[model samples]
Target chain A: MTALASDTRASRQPISFALLAQVILIANSFIMLYPVVVMVLSAFKTTGEIFDHPFALPDFTQVGNFTKVLGETEMPTYFMNSILVTGTSVILILVLGTMAGYAVARYESRTNTFILLFFLAGLMLPLKLAVIPLFILLRDLGLLDSRWSLIVTYTAIGLPSAVFIMAGFLRTLPLELEDAARIDGASEPRIMWSVMLPLARPPMAIAAIQNAVPIWNDFFFPLVFIQTDERKTLPQGLTTFMGEYTTDWGMLFAGLTIAAAPITLLYIVLSRQFIQGMTAGAVK
Target chain B: MLVSHKQAPSLKRQLWVAFLVVPPIAFMSLFVVYPILSAFAYAFYDWQGLARGEFVGLKNFREVLFGATMAPVVWNAFLHNVYALIALMVIQNGGGFVLAWLLYKEPFGFRFHRIAVFVPVVLSTIIVGFLWKLFLNPNFGIVNQALYALGLDSWAKPWLGDSSTALGALILANAWHFIGFPTLVYLAGMQRIPPEIIEAARLDGTNEWQLLKNIVWPLVAPSTTILFTLLFIGAFNWFEIPYVMVGLDGSPFGSTDVLGLVFYRTAFGNQSASIQNFGLGSALATLLFLFIVVFASMLTLWLRRREIQF
Candidate 1:
């Protein structure tokens, strides 16, 4: 009877330790979420109310920030451009990256090795290093101000990491599945699409989220490639908002809140997969 | 010999491979390779808008290497990168590793601690930048508010404005945002170590300290090498955060003028000095490329030596 109680006490100690640890973690998470929460609340506060009592509960009197953000600026246009650019770029990267990754993983040929190195080399080469000549090239193509130009640049940039992650994932997948598919009247493309890609979800999801986060947050590419206000994406749009209203902290925070919402919400929902995917990509 | 007999299958496979590889190759060559080569070509000529001048040979490279204005900018950028590297390798990486070590033993509440600290990792750099900007704002920012509340009003200064603190401020913000990444990576790496190894050490009268020093650290070396290399790349490509916080000129006294910012200013900014320096800009970019490529190659070599492939 003493031993039983002792066993329960011992277990309870670890549980109590765990509970304390959780409180600390919760407090830390609140610190992490503080700025995000502040921005979200800022988006709902009136300009006057924001400064009059910055930390107070935002007045339910007005939800004016969103209306102003949507109405007063080219934010809608920027949002559409962002979607088009990110969507098209991600598709191209996935398709091309998958094929390239598969070919590199499957074939043990010298040419395949060279191709892998060719793309992998770009992984270390910073995009800023190419900005000088890129500008000249785009100008010559008369694509400097165009949305598609940035899309093209983004696709190229996204491909290297995409290929690396996909290749790693492909290598780990059992080869027997492909061999069987090939034996069972499946062509290579059909095999990849039907058999391999469907199973490559773990890495693909990793690649997508990894690639998506950067593309969504990217400032440098759009900064250089797209000069026109109408063609700008969210980062550039936010910068424009900052330029016009540097002193308007409330509006600036509101704009930032809009920009941060989607990615943060997505991370909250998909964090487990996100972390797993990220670590998998990094280790590979 | 068997595949030679199956001509239809071989031809179809080849065709499919070609189809898959061609579009990406073409797209890459057009935007990536072509632009890079054009930058190389521009380095050999003097172009003052609309491709105006004769071949300058190595003059642009000479000016960038030997000229008065160009040398300091390059030095400043290199120094900035080194400072950032030190901060990331020391403060962020060190802090993260320590935290990870402490949290490794699933002592009640481990899950919450992991999730809380890692939230910063998922945020966009732009968002992180703006978030920190607001937090550090001199007037209405919470930082000042806290300082004043604690009766340390004189302790607060304009974080992004003062040249002395601007770079350091940016570094702190960056470290906060990215430290979680390496922590998680290290944690994942440590988790992969066989439990028996750790248990064996403990059973052999090894304390927690000895177990960690002998068993865990050695096992995590490969991951450490990879993390360091990646952090090096990230440091070298320091952009977005500085750009958002400090703008194109890297304000105050150009304290935050990283290589990325320098390249952007030279290539695209609407400054009179920047307007006619395409050749010089290309040369500078070429030099920056060589730096990163060489750095990456060296890291890969170092990584190969350290990698204990399990």
Candidate 2:
């Protein structure tokens, strides 16, 4: 169905007008990329140089800011904490959400519909609204300043969407596989663990990426629950860095770059996966 | 024995279901449900530090909604959130549609444009906020610097410093950060349109505008429903951007104040005042949550029904 009508009309438009549209897109891409590039460049310049020529190409050899940020600050510690917390949260979310999603998708229980809706409700109402009691509850439990505070909160926050994505995906898998496994004398848990779970890798990755990014980037939970310096994640820790070096432009930009680098690099490499993961919910 | 053989697996399935859903359900009940429920409970009590002092009934809710001191600030913050919501829906989502339409028509640089538009979206909100804050700095920021360079010096003012332009500046920064989300959503929607339908429309001598309006816009409804629901929630829960850029006080005389900031300041008082009042904060949180859930669900249902009609 090659559409001659639409193509002819598209071609009939003036070439210059079409060129203008292309240029606008290119210009937009430039605009989107430009600010971040300038920030990276500013990270290489001294405070004085930044004030003088903010846009000039900086000498790449001046790695002083990076060394100072990495050495003097707890940025590395924050990165480690972020990784640990985000990893644990994503794993928990994937496990719990998958089990629940599988149940809703495959099982013929009377409560499946209600159970699926229960998880779906979490998607609409944000967890931040519960901060008042959450703070009190965390402090009472003596988990206020621990990494577990973030881990638990994040798992709870992420479970709904993870469940949604998984259930939607699992329903599309043929029931014959499960039936075959059952006929082969595979135990219920064994079937799920061996056959279904492995096949669920794509949605699991989507769930992992979706949850990991937010947990890694979360500042509010750390700001609320984790009061100690050792427990702060990158986003909150970056704020601490900013507050400490208010006058040092190069160092601040360096800190920003450090905070942004991991995800940006990961995204650049796995951009298709990232896009698919984030917009997964919308499509479904 | 034969009946038992058939019943055994059914019983086993029940156990499996319990194992699968119980822990996650319990986990959610403990963390998400408990806190939300406790928020409602706390709304009725008075607090001293972390401890509940007395049962205050509707006092806290009254103070949050209608008190002489808190009412004005709360409403003001509420209005700012609404303004941001409307601005973002119009600017960010609207711009996204235009971009998606352009890309759908012109295949040149399709791959690059798709990836590039979404780059900022996946970045940390904290980074986006800090980057924009730095960009909008009065003297040395690139925004003003670029304006000056382009001989638009008269247009460059202290964007965040001036109260009048402060909220608008934050909204623009937000739009810049998230415009790609709607772009991707709308693009996906536009791509799903069958080419034959478009061809049939074109054969009738319909122009691009008519095609977009009559054909594309209506079909983008599903995306619209999702994006609208998300934007509404994001706007109302808008915290990180204003908090990072303008600071907790919503400074420059509180022009950028939002409900989240007010709730934060109220729940756990800031540097200026340290008198924490959990009661009033819970009341405020309860009201905000209820408002969001009720209205957003209604809006979604309405949009969904409209989608069916379209």
Candidate 3:
């Protein structure tokens, strides 16, 4: 009886330790969520109310701040521009990257290895340093101040990682599928498109999400390359808008909330895939 | 009778491979490789925006490194970047490792904790910057409010306004935004450890602390190396946070200035300087590039030597 009692006590110790860990994690998560939650909530409050009752729940009837942000500002145009740029860049990266990744993964040669290393070297090249010459190059090409410049630059920047991820993923798929497809008289492109591309979807999604977030949120390139207010992406627009409306706390909060909404909603909806995709690149 | 088989790929397959590979290579080389090389070339020339100036050999470099007026700003920004590196290494990565270990134990609500922790990472840094700017507002900010509510009113101050606390505040905000990245990476590393080895260690009378210190940490060295390399590179390239939270000048007496901001301000003048200096900017950019390359290589080599093969 004493032995059984001791066994139960020993088991209870670990359970208690786990429970303590749970408490710590929950508290830390609250700290993580606090600022974001406050931002979202403050979007609905008047500036005076925000200053008066910063922590209290606002009366739900006042959503004029959000309306003002969307209706009065150029936010909707910025949103469209962001969507267009990010979507187009992501598509270009995935298509070109998958093609290159497939070639490198399928062909085993010294040249292919060299090509792989070339792309991998880009992972650490500090491309931000190239901004000056890139400016010159774009100007020389008459591509300055165009959204196409951002799209093209984003695609170039995103390609290395996308190719890296796609190549790693393609190498894992069994070779027999390709062989079988080849034996069935399917061309190499046909095999790649019909057989391999389908298998490559998960990694494609991972690479897309990984690259898409940065492209959508990128402010540096837009700040440098974009000249006009109408062409500004969300981050640049928000920065400019905030500069003009720095004292209008309610509108600033609403503007921030609008800027963060799409990606936040996507993250909440696909948090699992998002986490898995991000961690997948890190682990390998 | 054995059928004759061609081992090497046919000409059609070669064309197909070229078709697959050529476009990305061309695009990357044209945009990425060419621009970087040209930037290096431009560092030596005394060119302003579009006009080709005299070929001044290493004059721009000398001025950027040793000139009377610009050198102090350059050195100050470099030191701030070094501080960012140390702070992130100690606070962000260190905290991430601890949280990863806790999450690895699969405590109650681990899934929720995992998802919630990474929430800030997905948001734009501009938004994160603005959010924190509001939260650290002196009059109506929640940080000061909470401090006062807890009777620690003396501890609260204007976080972004004061020079002494500005860089530290920016570092804290950066760490908060990125802690999720290292946590998830380290958690993945910890999950890769074989369970039976842990069981065997436990049976051999090792305490949890001992196991973690001896077995778990060594196995997670890959994740550590990755995090360190990334943090090191990111430190040198720090810009958006300071640019948004402060300004291009890295305001409040330039306490929060970073190398990236220095380069930006030099290239595209702000309140301080109205005229753009392209040659000096290229020199600064080249210096940044070289610093990242050399330091990252050395760090990777050192960290790679420490990785234990299990």
DockQ of each model against the real complex? 0.47, 0.58, 0.66
Q: Model 3, stretches more than 4 Å misplaced?
A: A1-16, A108-110, B1-6
Candidate 2, position B192, lDDT: 83
How high is the CA lDDT of each candidate model?
0.76, 0.88, 0.88
Clashing pairs in 1: A18-B108, A18-B109
Lowest lDDT block of 10, candidate 2 chain B: B1-10
| Model 3 C-alpha lDDT per residue in residues B1-310, reported as the tens digit of each score | 2211125777877888899899999999999999989998888888766665988989999999999999999999999999999999988899899899999988778889999899998988999888888888887889998898899989999989999899999999998899999999999999988989888998997767898899998889999998999899999999999998888889889899999999998888887577788899999999888888898989988988878877
Q: For candidate 2, write residues B1-310 as lDDT tens digits.
A: 1122224347768898899989999999888888988889999999998889889899999998999999999999999999999999999989899888878875688889888989889888899999998889899888998899899999999999999999999999888888888998899888888888888998997777898898888888888999899898899999999999999989888899999999999998998998889999999999998999899989999998757332
Off by over 4 Å in 1: A1-30, A105-110, A171-188, B1-9, B50-52, B270-276
Pairs in steric clash, model 3: none
Q: How many steric clashes does model 1 contain?
A: 2
lDDT of 1 at A86: 82
Give the residue spans of candidate 2 off by over 4 A.
Answer: A1-17, B1-10, B308-310
* TM-score evaluated only on chain B, model 1: 0.90
Model with the higher DockQ, candidate 2 or 3: 3
Model 3 chain B: weakest 10-residue lDDT segment is B1-10
Q: A1-284, model 3: which lDDT tens digit per residue?
A: 99999888877877787887888798879989988888888899988888888888877788999999999999999999999999999999999999899998877645797788879877668678999889888988888898988999999999999898999889898877878777777877888889989988989999998889989999999999998889999999999899888888989989998999999999999998888776665786
iRMSD of prediction 2: 2.5
Model 3 DockQ (Cα-based): 0.66
